[model samples]
Every structure is written in structure tokens, then in C-alpha cells.
Target chain A: MEGETIVKERRILVAVDESEESMYALSWCLNDLLSLHTNTNTTVLLLYVKPPPPAYSSLDATEYIFAGDAIASMEKYSRDLAHSVMSRAEEVYRDFHPRVKVEKKVGSGDAKEVICVAVEKLGADILVMGSHDYGFFKRALLGSVSDYCTKHVKCPLVVVKRPKNV
Target chain B: MEGETIVKERRILVAVDESEESMYALSWCLNDLLSLHTNTNTTVLLLYVKPPPPAYSSLDATEYIFAGDAIASMEKYSRDLAHSVMSRAEEVYRDFHPRVKVEKKVGSGDAKEVICVAVEKLGADILVMGSHDYGFFKRALLGSVSDYCTKHVKCPLVVVKRPKNV
Candidate 1:
């Protein structure tokens, strides 16, 4: 960052839960980064966490809420979720920041862990993601992330809020 | 925390450094909260930690250095710094957030701690502040205060880039 334009060179990471809220956030992040006329490269990861396969039992209250050793079924679900999320993400990006370059990744893992791993692996300087749900927002805040990075990492982090539109 | 129409009810703790950059942050925070139209009562704490008076130095390079404290003079300088900071802070609030009920406290302590302590005692749900030097867009935030709040606190934080006007 020695005398270089800070906004011009940006590497952004957006975590996608395939929710309309997440897509909206990605849209804002992409457009805002490009608006700065910055060199922007975005890698969006559509992440899904698999709750441990529910104990298969007839007496289970929500017995059907189980994803058994159903590898084939899981793969199909993953592909479908990825397809929908990417389609929405791409559409939003095209509408807001068509010129910005983007790469996509889809995986199943803990949302926070997946994000932390991607940030490190990509050497991303900015992590642009959605405001978390009330439960998770407590720990996962745009504010908290920026604070954490500022204290520990020598990079910049931008946390974008979701627009009202779906 | 019950059913309510108040928007942006997140408690915002704004730290003022008495710098133009800080004032911009001050305005942005007020406007942002006001827009939410929440039961937003902003407590603006004007913090100014006076540098200890320079010891009568005969040595070279002493001009640029912070000479050790003149214990006797610390009280006078501290009092003066407090008055100057609070006056400026009031003017800033009157100009920007006239509707916001304001409060002032001067701590002759570290900037970050004073801010963190205020937030804890007041149950601030948000921290608003400004960053120091950056590039063309003075708001290209890469600062210690904003970063510190982001990492250590749980509330949502909004850091306004110092308005470029100044």
C-alpha cells in the first residue's frame, strides 16, 4: 500500500447463503468497489453448512429433517443451490457492476470457517458480506470484522448492508 | 427491546478526536441515526487527552519529542484541553444533530480506553468514528479507532470517511 491508491486495488470476498439478503449485499459491494474506478476482483463463495445428519429414527420429532448418508442427494441439492445463488448473484452484479470481474466457488462448510479460510487463501484485502441474522449478527458484524482486521490484520474490510429489494 | 417502531435503535457511541476528520464522522453518524428515526438518543462524549507539559528541556531533538510530564502543569493543561474539546464538540453537535440530546464527558486517559469504557457503561450498541490519513477520498478509512471498535465490541459500528470538503 506504499503510496498506492487504496481503493483502486481491491480483492473482495462475499459469503453467500443463497438468501436474497446475501445477493443484495453482493450487488452493493460489487457496484461500490467499481464505482471507485478501482481494480476489483471478486470471489464469491456460496456456502451451506450441513447440520450433522439427523439421527434416523421413526420417533424423531422432525424425522424427515435428516440428510442421511445421502451423498448423491446432497450433491444434487448443492448443485441446485449453487445454480440459483450464482444466477441471482450474477444478475445483481450485471445490473449494478457489469465491468467488475468475478469468480465463484460453492461448498458445504461452517459459514464462518469457510469465510475465514477463503480470506486467507485468496489474500483478499476486503471481506464484503451481508449483515448476519439477529442470532449470528451478534458475533458476525460488519463492525466486528472491521475492528478485528484493523487490530490484527493490516488490510481494509468493508461490510455492506443489504438493500431492501429482493 | 420489545415491539417498537423505532428504527436504527442500535446504540451509537461516537468518539471525537477534535480533528476535522472526526467532525465529519460525527455528522455522518448523526445523520445516519436520525434517518432511522429510532428512539435515538445520542450521547456525544468529547474526549481530549492533553499531552503532558514538556519539561524544560535543554537537550537537542527535544522539540519533536514529548518531554516528560510537568506534574504541576498537567492539571492546568488538562483543564484547558477539556474546555476546548467540549466547546468544539457542542458546536459540532448543534450544527449537525440539534435534535439529538447530547452529553459530554472529558477523560484524561487514552482515547481508545475512554471510548471503550464509555460504550460499556452506556450500553452502546453501535460505535461511530472517523479515520486518519488516507488517499484522495479522505474517507478511505484505515485507522486505529475504527479498527479497534470493529474488533473488540459486539455492536454494529459505522465509520464515516472524513468528508472530503475539508
Candidate 2:
């Protein structure tokens, strides 16, 4: 082993959301991939992206006055959701890979852009995501995050699709 | 641990080709993913697809008579190419994952269909592929195999994009 360069650590970013599919992905990554991998230096990065604050175009004085309050409440709601999602992900990690280090990340912007940027900025070795399996029409309308990341993310990307029975 | 149910084995199907990208994928899967993973129960299935024999429709007696010989020679060339590709892949596996169990499979058809069918038939827990990174125009015209498999394959799909500096 002398003179041999050993990879001390690897960062794996897992994108989570409120959807059941995302949770399943986190569980699968932990139970099947992380737990099975012998690399003790692996760190799991759990990322949750909140949509950007809504823009209010209303010019009415009354509507403009309340816009700040409305935006504040929406931001608070987003923060709460992110926390809850991270907690759920942490629970799965604790159950499956209790010893592995886990980092929580919350980004606000388009999910696709935020995820791609995070992978690059965090220097993730691998990026794991859950596929929504939105059918043709819906996928076209909604734009799939995994699909975008597959094309844009610089690192290796894994898209886990939950089985129907599960 | 006596009564704990342990998964005896997992199948990881890796699609290979003559392209450097696919070879890079195989190496990455072995060195970065398989070598680090503690699971000794993993089995790698290497699948290679050769394009279907060319169709010859010649009404002339002389042309028809020569067509058989031409087709035979082409078939032989295809077989030889497949063998060469397999040998190259085996070499990589030997260097990186000598002890890991690897099964070689050669199928003749469209790569997309063959890969998807093989994944389902083999009950692969994960499918690893290399992205060609064909830009928009090229991808639109040639159709990316990884993109197709990502949408169709039942198991989790990992698309490894070789780092540009590498």
C-alpha cells in the first residue's frame, strides 16, 4: 500500500422532496448503495430545493402593501417544508447508515439549476435522484429534474425509479 | 446477525461498446463504485450489442447469388468485432476488479431495446452506462442510448460522464 494514493472520501448528493418517490430514493441509496459500500469515508449530501419566491405584479396600493407579508409567510412555509423533508431523509439515513456523515443543504431556485450547481460547487462524486415518472404529456409540461440533471450535471448521476409495488 | 436476512447477491448490468466513453464507464464502475463497495455479492453483467445484419434485396440472379457470400462475410466481421470488444472489456475488469464475477453477453439488435430487455431479463438491480455527451444536434439526430434507457429501464440507471480533464 506504500505510495498508493487512496481516495479518502467521496461526496454523494441525494436530492430530496416531499414526494414519496424522493423519499424512496433516499432510502434506497442508503440501504442498498451506501450501506453495501465498504467506503467508510462516504458523506451523503441531502439537498432540498425550495421554489423561488413568487413575484407580485399587482400595482394596486393595497395589494402592494400586503405583498411583503405574503412573501414572508411563503418563505417561512418553504423553510418548514425543507426542514421536514430533511428530517425524513435523516431518519432513513439513521436507520440504514447510522455511521455515515450526512450534510443537509437547502437551495432556493429552479430545482434543476440548483441541483446542477450544487453538484459542481459541493464537488460531489455522484449525484442520486428519484424519477417522478411523469408520463409524456405531464413530463413535457412539468420538466423532469432528473432528466435535466442527467444532461447537465458534471458528475456521475444515478436516477432511481421506485418500483410500482413498493 | 444469525437470523438477519442478508441479500445473497445483486446484479449490476453494464453496457459496453468500442467507444472510449463506454470503456471509461466500465473502469469508473469498477474502480470508483465496485472496488469501494463492500458487498461481495455483486455480479456485473457486461452486455454488448452488434447492429443487425444488413438487409440485401437484389432481384437479379447474379446479385442475389453473391449476396449470400457478402452477408456471410459481414456476419463474420461482426462476430469478430464483438469478440474484440469483449476482450478489451475483460482486460479492464481484470485490472480493476479481478475477483468480481462478470458475465459476458452479446446481443444483436438496436442497442436501446436490447439493453432495456436485458436489464429486465437479468433482473439487474442497477444499470450503469457511459454518456457520450453528444451535443444537442448530434443527440437529436443519433438519439442517446443512455437517455432512452433512463426512461425505459426498470432498474436504477447510473450514467457516468467521463471528466473532461481525464
Candidate 3:
């Protein structure tokens, strides 16, 4: 305790997705973590990762050709999805603690890789995420983003599990 | 801020094991989380879950029979392992912040189930655990305990990932 200094402002980066579990994790962070530090400067960064667009293959060019307008609409849809998720997260944060500073960030890449890189780039003190609660068989089929992030992220990570009753 | 009551004492249950990841998690909790609340009542519960002993079967017991002394010594070893983990956690807490109230708990059962039950019974505000950082194939072959707890636990959870350089 002699030389140790307490951090006044804690940078908390929360990864958000379009799932109830993610929303629940955001709510918990706002209510339980941020609310407690009302007097301190706690910056909460809301991050949403969009999957990288599908790659164009030479053989697929003949089979599945995308129209110009279709590509534009698809890009627009991805942007809109990112905005919507951030807006919802902001709404929840405002409802819980309006005065707290929050920033929205959207990254493009694989979810796990993007999250880890963002945490490092942002210099976040802690990274909070939501568990999708996949079953054994389902997890085997579809990999877990949180699991990957937990191992790869440079900062401390928190993976929140939404209670069933909640 | 009007009429809002801040929780003074937050009970944080940290699940520790005989892994470097768990020790790193304990260190992070002390430096990042608990250090911020030195003036307040912050209770950190260090929990270690030992896998339950193998069930004995009569048919195969003829070839794989364990002596009475060996069984007693194995039980003793498990108990000692639990104690050693908790002691190490306590030492880390003491080294970082001695003022924080720290409690050690050991449970015998599946790691995931024990952690969830301990969080509920202890009325913990949050449960912090460490990830083993298994790769895709490794995790697929042997399931992750932290991943399981993240899905099953009722309270807020933090899965701390040790930095590569640290």
C-alpha cells in the first residue's frame, strides 16, 4: 500500500451483440459496476463487432452474382445493425446511469479477434462480455466468442451469464 | 444520484485453482477491482472446487483396487490441495490490499456446479474466475470449467485472462 496508487477512472469496455445475454450483461455492468462509481470518472465503451463480409470466390462469381444495389443494401444493413445495437445499449445505460460517460465503437472482423484487438487498442482496464450459454453439443458445433476472447484479450475480462429468471 | 443508495460491501466470489490462470485472476482482482474500494467494506471470497472422488465399482474393483491407506491419503491430498490454493490466494490479497476482507471456501463437486452454488449461497455480488485459455480443438475435446460456469452461474461473472507478457 505504500507505493500503490488507486486508479481514479476505470475504463470498462463492454462487447455488445444482438442477443438478450449481451443486453443483460450491459444492464448488469451499468447497474452493479458503473452505478457504484458515480462520483468517479468511469468511461464505459460499448463495442459491437460485425462479422467480415463474405469473400468473393472466382468460381462463385459465375454461380452467385450479387447485384450492385444488393451489395449497397447489404452494407447499409450491417451499418444499421451496428447502430441499433449501440443505441439499445446506450438506452440501457442512460436508464441506469445517465451521467456516466459512454462511447460507442464498431469493429469489423471476426468477433473474437476484433474484441481482443479493441481491448488492447482502447487500453481498457477490463473487458466485459456476455455468454451465449450454448449447450455442450451446440458449443461443439458453434465456437464461443467469449471463450476465445477470454484467452486472447490482453486486459482483464468478465463474461457475464444472464440468469434464467432474469 | 437522488435517493440512490450505493452498496458499501460487495461480496466478490473468486474461484481459484492450482493453475497460473487462477493466480493471475486473483492478482488482477486485487490490483484492479478491490484496490479501488480500500475505504469501503469489500469482501472477497476465494473459492476452490475439488473434483469429487471417483465412484467405486465392485466389478472392476478387483483389478483396480485401492488400499485403505491409499484412499485416505488421496483424500488428504485433495484437502491439502484446496488449502494450499486458498493460502496462496490469501497471500496475494495480503500483498496487494490487506484491509479488504477476504474469505476462503472449498467445495467438493463439479467445478462449475460448485461455483454456481457457492455464489448463490454466499449471496455474492459477482463471481470472478480464470480461463485456462484452451484452443478450439482442446476445448472441444475437454470442456472448459469457466465456460460452463459462465452459462450456469446466477450472479455476475468475470473470467480473467492473464496477459501474455505478464
Candidate 4:
């Protein structure tokens, strides 16, 4: 006992979005990953990344193409969306394991970039995310945020797919 | 006790290849997923999918473009590769948990289709795979096998990314 070192608590980051795919991932993390003996002291980090606000050119700004109130409402909507996602994730976590410690984080930027940066900053042992199962054309057009994070994140990454019936 | 229902053994399918990424995934599965208390009755299916052999056109057949011996040797090489990958995975499994059950399976066809079909045929509850973390250009040029499987596999799919320094 004198020479033994204490094991550090594992940090697991789950990326939450508004889609059911993401909610299923949260459930999977709670049921499959966190409920394991190996994850006894794990801490879950619920993260939501919202796309950055649209940029307007100087000419458009001067012409008042978008009203100030409209821009304010759009910003508020994004914030509300992020908050709602985190709240739903919290409910799922509480339902699965109420005693587990969880932290909620929100960032506005490219989802891929925000996820990668948060994983590093949080020193996460593993990052969990849900895949939307986008087809070839859609994936090519929209670009896969999880795919990008898989390449950029330094920690082990788990991309969970939602079951069809779910 | 007389009325107790039997618990079904969980099947976990892991897609293995000749790359370090796949090997890392095998290691992670053994250490993290299989070592958990909830996985006591789990059986792991190690699958290796070899690309389909090149097709010979009628013109090529008439011209005798491919040497018979060369074609035979190439097929043998692919078989050998699949065998070696399974052997390596077995080593990893034994290193982590010697008592766990593991089965090796080999298929020839498009990697994506083979993996999806194997998961269904095996009735796997979960499919585990490794991501090579290919860049955007390479991924677009040569479609990712794991990406395709993630979208197509009916079971819960876990795509693991190896830690950068590891």
C-alpha cells in the first residue's frame, strides 16, 4: 500500500445533438459504458457544439439586410437549443445512474473543431458520439463531424450507431 | 430458481485487418469492453474481410493476360494475410482475458458488405471496428470501410480510434 498509486477517475465526453441518434448514444454510454465495472469512477462530460453564427458582409450590415432583432433571436435560439440538448442528456444520465457525476459544456463553432478542442482540454479518456448514418451523397455534401473528430482527437473515440428500430 | 429464464450469450463482432489501427481496436475491445462484469457471457467474433479477387475480362482471358500461377499465389497470399490477422487478434485476446470465447471468421468481397453481412449472420449484438483516421481527400477518393459499416450494420456499431501517441 505504501508504494501503490491511486487510479485517476476516467473522463468520458459524450457529444449531444438534438437528433435521436445522439440521444441513443447518450443512453448507450449510460447503459453500456458507464455501467461497467471498469468505469466505476468515470465522470461523464456532456458536450453540445452549436454552429457559429452566420457572418454578414459590411455592405449587408450597412444595408441592414438582417434586422438587429432577427439576429438577436437567432443567437438566442442557438443558445436555447444547446441548453435543451444538455437538459435532455442530463435526464437520461439521471435515469440511468443518478449517482454518477456529470458536467455540461457548450461551445459555438464548427462542431468538429469544438469537439476536438474540448476532448483535449478536458483530458478525456474516451469520446463517445452518435452517427446519423448519412448516405454517401449527404456525407460528402455535409462532411462528417464525427469522422473529422476521429482523426483529430488524441484520445480513444467511440462512434455509436443507433439501432434501426430505435 | 425453478422459473428462472436463461440468459442469452452476447455476441460481439470485431472487424480486424492487417493494420495497427485494427489491432489497437482488438486490444481495446479485450481490455475495455470484454473485461467488464456485464460481459461475462459474451462471445467475440473476429472477422477479417479480404477484397474480392480481381475479375478477368473475356478479352484478358483470351489474351491470357494473367499467369495462372501468379493468380493462385495472390489468392494464397490473401488467405495467409487473413489468417495472420486473426492470429494476432487471438494473441491480444489471450493477453487480456484468456478465458473469454473468441471465434475467427474470414470473408472475401467488398469489406463493407462483408462486415455488414457477417454481423447479421452472426446475430451480433454489437460490431466493433477501427478507424484509420484517413484525411478528407483520401477518404473521399477511397471510401472508408468502417464508415460504410457504421451506416449499414443493423446492430450497435462501435468505431474505435487509437490514441495518437499509442
lDDT per residue (tens digit) for residues B1-166 in model 3: 7897665688999889999889988888877776544455688888998879866566455445555556678899999998888877777887655577788888998888888888899999888888787778998887888767767777777878777787
Which tens-of-lDDT digit does each residue in A104-159 have in candidate 3?
89999888898888988998998888888877899888788876776677677777
Which docking class does model 4 fall in? acceptable
Residue lDDT tens for model 1, A31-150: 433333323333443333332322445645443544343545776776777787778777776654445556776645545555666667777654555554333466554334333333
lDDT string, candidate 4, B1-166, tens digits: 6896754577889899999999998888777765445534677889999989876555456445455666688899998998888888877888555466788888999889999999889999878888888788999988988767766777667778877788
Query: What's model 1's overall lDDT?
Result: 0.54
Q: Where is model 4 chain B poorest over a 10-residue stretch in terms of lDDT?
A: B57-66
Give the Å error, residue A97, model 1: 23
1 versus 2: better lDDT goes to: 2
The regions of model 1 sitting more than 4 angstroms off are A1-166, B1-10, B38-69, B95-98, B134-143
Q: Could you estimate the TM-score for every candidate?
A: 0.45, 0.92, 0.82, 0.85
| Candidate 1 global TM-score | 0.45
* Candidate 2 residue-wise lDDT, B85-144, digit = tens: 999998889965656889999999999999999999998999999988888999999898
True-vs-predicted CA distance for residue B126, candidate 4, Å: 2.4
Model 1 has fnat of 0.02
